[model samples]
Target: MIAPDPLYPVLETERLRLLCPAAPDFDAMAAYLAPGTRDFVDLPPDPESAWWSVATTIGHWHLRGYGHFAVVDRRSGEHFGLVGPWFPHGWPEPELSWQLLDGAEGRGIATEAARAVLDWLFLEKGWSSCISMIAPGNARSLALVERLGARSEGMFHHRLTGELRIWRHVARTATGRKLMEGFA
Candidate 1:
């Protein structure tokens, strides 16, 4: 039998905790993404996809060695949303992504969590690059990637998901690692 993953550590920032998602997290995840979370995917996702979404999140820890983190309100312990790496099976590369609960918008939670994950990926994991794919119509995500200093690489059809524009950030030197370490 497979051993269980340790309880996710609390990734404490001055104002947030980017913890790993668990079964209990699904309710808040669902509620946070309510009105429509699947609609945010590049392709039309199942409206009832929360169960699989959670499983996939767990699977990331086992397979990819990293995964999306649940953004918890530091003080209240409320579940906010998630920001981290996701790679569907057989995909060429992992994508950095986020989804903030409705109330958590405009507060920079996504940006903070994403930067933290990127820093971990680079410094701790020795990854040189990571990418984010955005739908042309998703201005919010586009703006977030830009703010994170990721540049648009190009557009491509996902074959299964229609059109997607790829944005990437690569660290050639250790400079970004230092900057990211300072954020934690």
Candidate 2:
């Protein structure tokens, strides 16, 4: 039962909370990023690498203003995973990225959090479009993106994550023009 960083915006869905990747989320994230057969992330198979990954996530918010949100259970305050807007170096454009802890699987946490993030990115931030890169054989991830109604544009050969299938999503609203536009 740890609290998320309050410096960043805290978004809430029906059953979860999306908060900044503060220090408290490290242990959970480390376990999720643990070395395994899964190639969900491209970090080196070293113990210290998880710390750096967590550090980078914290820095990402400072650098980009908006980054992945630590998914926490509203009632329990436990970090389930991370899901949100992500744009790292070498990426062709901003993407909707997601990763989940084992406990969070098969419970619709990713889908719920992703929808909330999409609304923030497209409706609140007024982003035009976004893409999600999924590992080739990650059925859960591929299915999640499909459920979100994203279409496969093609494969993108990431410098770190290797070749991944790209799913594209566009804002339903046309261009998200601000209501206060042209008033001044």
Candidate lDDT values, in order:
0.69, 0.75
- lDDT by residue (115-184, candidate 1, tens digit) is 7777666666678778898988988898899988887878767678778898986654455443333222
42 in model 1: Cα distance from truth in Å? 12
Worst lDDT window (10 residues) for model 1?
1-10
Off by over 4 Å in 2: 1-7, 22-50, 173-184
Query: Quick one: RMSD of model 2?
Result: 5.9
Clashing residue pairs found in predicted model 1: none
Across 1-184, the per-residue lDDT of candidate 2 in tens digits comes to 1223445667888899888765453353554454440343465646576667777887888888888887878898766768988888999899999878656789999999998888777767778678999998999998999988788889899777899988987666444443333321
lDDT of candidate 2?
A: 0.75
Instruction: Give the clash total for candidate 2.
Output: 0
Clashes of each: 0, 0
Report the C-alpha displacement of residue 175, candidate 1, in angstroms. 4.8
Q: Which candidate is the best by TM-score?
A: 2
